[model samples]
Target: MVEQGKEQETKDFHPAPVWLDESYLEPLLRDLKKDPGLRITELEIKPATAKGDNYASVMTRVKILFLRSSAKIPEIEYYIVKTTYENDPFASDIFSKYQVSTTEMLMYEKVLPQLSALIEETRQPEKVFAATLHVDYEHDAIIFEDLAVSKHVLADRLIGFDLEHTRLALRKLAKMHAAAAVLNERKPGILTKFDHGIFNRYTKGFAPFFENLCDVAADFAATCPELGDHYARKLRELRKRVMEYSARVYDPQPDEFNTLVHGDFWVNNVMMRYGERKEPLDMILIDFQFCSWSSPAVDLHYFFNTSVQKPIRYEHQEELVQYYHTVLVETLKDLKFGGYTPTLRQFVLQLERGGFFAVTVALTCQAILTNDQTADADFNALMKDDERGRNFRKVLYHNKTLQENLKYMLPRFDRSGLLDVID
Candidate 1:
């Protein structure tokens, strides 16, 4: 049976913590003071941009009072705190069932240092992707950094983009992939030590949930006669393929082109502040819970399918692929002593590999995309909403948007020799 607060329905649930309790705040303050004489006088928690199953997070602003020998010195204010929680939600019952929470804390203590070091080494101090773990072991709470103040980007808002913005963003992605690739090569043993058992455990239970969700979508579609058949057929196909597709696409083994991927690299996970009306000032990436070692193509394909608008995709698919490839090659050369660039033929081959994965991504994301509710809605709601119900009905009966996306994608893949590999 699910735990009271741990039900899947409450997965997206985040209750605000308006006031900071001294019992919880004291231990964390002690930890922060170990480095210096910073005393936190005020603590406030507000909603953060991301969410996960184990923890509810918020931005924390800390006002510090510093003791001074000099009269000129005054109180200092600084902001730093991160999502803090135990990993009890992730531990298996078979592992010390009675001491589950204790065991979870021990595991986090072991892993936290290595994870922190890796984040510090790879990312800029200001742009670190990994959350710092300020474990207040005594109180069972953690305090670290508030990412929103330093770096964060919104998901739903679409600002205008031109060719230059597209090129630079692709370059940044290439740099990320190259850095991961070099790390994997240089420290093969160390990198391999990080386990993906958590993903396997979470997704194993989630398979049945996804099937039920597809069924829910189909049931909703049935109420609308005109679109019912269409949605029913599409959901049926999705149900049949979901498991098989996941298995093939989620391989964790390392290859030359496989690197650390932002598994859900869509528009929402990326943040951009605009300079004027159309130009972007900076792009900040968030949500590292789904991040793992995977094919670089997965990240590239996801960005193309979900982030870029339809008009841009239809017109610029080939050019965009080439541009991303160019950046990837350049980045690898800089990161490695004598990294060899793929030939045009080899580049095209990699892009084909990306297209193969795109089929599964595009189909699954369609349920979220075309649904009337915001795409960011919880998975269960996406499955149950009536407008999505109507949309699914139309898809099942008429096969409109899915057909169009596939028709547009397949020709590009075929022309580029991707279909031959798929067949």
Candidate 2:
């Protein structure tokens, strides 16, 4: 939620967070003071500027005041607070379960640290993840160092990233996956706690967001009735096929080549850093809410299909896929992985099985992209008009990017036999 115009002068928060309020604030401050390193004096909380975030996000901005001394530290520290409340109305009706939320904090508290250690031990230049400051067991909230204030800037979801951006992102992804593999190899069973895939859980229990996306795709395809019939028919049928088959996306037979996947890997979830020449420099992946165990191709197909546009994809699909596989193999081997890398054939099959997810993600992402209702709506504004918090089903059917990709990808997916209903 975008917090604007609600910055109060005192500790009395404007529409205080559901779990964190004045009562919790004082003690939380006290807890920090327990550490000799942190002699905090005051705190200021407000809504952070959230635009084009997940529909279920409830973010808060915190300003920490430290006691000034010879410690020679910056007096103010800023944090971005992320929480998924159990009783959130939208979360309840749409994405009711937040097992993903718990796992994300776990990943930060445990998984990511191990991964970072491996990266440093292996002397890898690529950075896999971001930094987290604090997490509350009771409030279901996590505080992260505010990267926004630094060279890091949010990736524009509407425009998406280009080839250079894609390569760097893939390298980072490989490092992360390899770290997990090595962590499991060294300790054995460290990642078991996150064995349940978040996408799998949501696909099974929540509303079929895919159907709504297919509905929009069908409508978008109907723009040219003659040429659109195949796409429209394919899309309409895809609605049913998607729900029934998508659950298997999380499953790979007998755990052949499973690794932890960043379930929500797309342009929006990444924050890109830029060099002075305006070239892509580095990135930090955010919104860890959906991290879980799955095939590496799950992340690959998602970014390649939805984020990479058709022209670039058509030109470089095989090369790009090979690049990702090569990096994954090299990174894992460097860390002395006990298991051999998945065969290229197996990776291709993973892409084939998981390609359907890209289709739905393409639809849902473009829907939210085209939908203006909340795209630009501010936090306080949504609070004032609760109707602004509607689902992505205001489904904008005529989105140009959506149409262009579908015209090309829908047929490709059909040819690859990814969409079972079409055949």
Q: Residues 1-423, candidate 1, lDDT per residue (tens digit)?
A: 668545532354443343445445545555655533444454444334333221222334454444333334555534444333323332222222223233234333543344334334533322324344555455433444444454344534233235555555665576566566566666664433332321232344345334554554455445545445655555565665555555455565333356666556666555565655546666655444344566566677767765565666678867877877776666566555243356656756665654555644554454344333232343333233466534443343233454456546644544654333221
Candidate 2: deviation at residue 391, Å?
9.6
| Deviation in Å, model 1, residue 209 alpha carbon | 5.4
Model 2 weakest 10-residue run by lDDT: 7-16
Instruction: Give the clashing residue pairs of candidate 2, or none.
Output: 2-379
Model 2 over residues 1-423: C-alpha lDDT tens digits?
Answer: 235434331222223376665455545554654643445567677765355455455667777777544456547767778776455555443343547667778887777877887887664655667787678867777877777667788666667778898888888887788778778778876774564454564435443455655665777777754347777777788777675565567664554677778877877777888989889888888777667667776687677765665655779777778788888887787788987478778777767667777676665655654343444332222222233322334325445666666667777777776655633
Candidate 1, residue 400: the lDDT equals 49
Candidate 2 — what's its lDDT?
Answer: 0.66
The global C-alpha lDDT for each of the candidates, from Candidate 1 onward, is 0.48, 0.66
Q: What TM-score, computed on C-alpha atoms, does each candidate reach?
A: 0.64, 0.84
Evaluate residue 381 in candidate 1 and report its C-alpha lDDT on the 0 to 100 scale: 33
What TM-score does candidate 1 reach? Answer: 0.64
